[model samples]
Target: METTPAPAAPARRRRSRAPFPVTVTQMPMATCQVCGRALAHRKGEVSAILTAHYERDHPELLGR
Candidate 1:
């Protein structure tokens, strides 16, 4: 007797933007307080970075 073949799995949809989980220990490269933009360039002025409101709601700056 011939065995029946297994059914094929459903195809997954390709995503342009994928959701991911991040750990707390991982420090961001560069943070922008105004627009909440992650950048490579460091902020020269401490006051500018600290005083500006970050859209992303950076938790690292909470205590400091």
Candidate 2:
């Protein structure tokens, strides 16, 4: 009697990879807490900017 051929092995499934995208973020800006107004410069700004702001708005606090 003739014998039947064996069955072939099953194919392996491919795995999917996760995709990554580039992202950008903004930095916090400097602001005055006294009047709750935005500052002209960013964080770590020069003292002159602060002095000018105070002299202009809070001159009384400066005590000339």
Candidate 3:
């Protein structure tokens, strides 16, 4: 006698929601004019820290 084959399982249904892309904004940081290093500041705004850094790092360039 011939045997019958079993039926295959149904495919699963997935959610229709699509994934969203994320974006980020980067602000530029201030750099020290004397040593060419990044200066410490907040919200992309420079303060007296740059001046103090220049005076302490390169006082010879201040007079020129």
lDDT per model, in order?
0.57, 0.75, 0.74
* Model 3 C-alpha lDDT per residue in residues 1-64, reported as the tens digit of each score: 9988888889899979887988866655788765689865667356677777777888888873
Which whole-number lDDT from 0 to 100 does residue 16 have in model 2? Answer: 91
Error of 1 at 38 (Å): 31
Task: Please report how far candidate 2 places residue 27 from its true position, in Å.
Answer: 8.5
Compose the digit string of candidate 2's lDDT tens values, residues 1-64. 9999999889988769766887865545557768977765655664667788889999888896
Give all candidate RMSDs, comma-separated. Answer: 12.4, 15.8, 11.1
Q: In candidate 1, what are the lDDT values of residues 1-64, reduced to their tens digit?
A: 9999999999998898967987655333555645566654344654444445442365556664
Full ranking by lDDT = 2, 3, 1
Write down the lDDT that model 3 would get: 0.74
- Please say which candidate is ahead in lDDT: 2 or 3: 2
Residue 31's C-alpha lDDT in candidate 1? 57
- lDDT value, residue 45 of candidate 3: 51
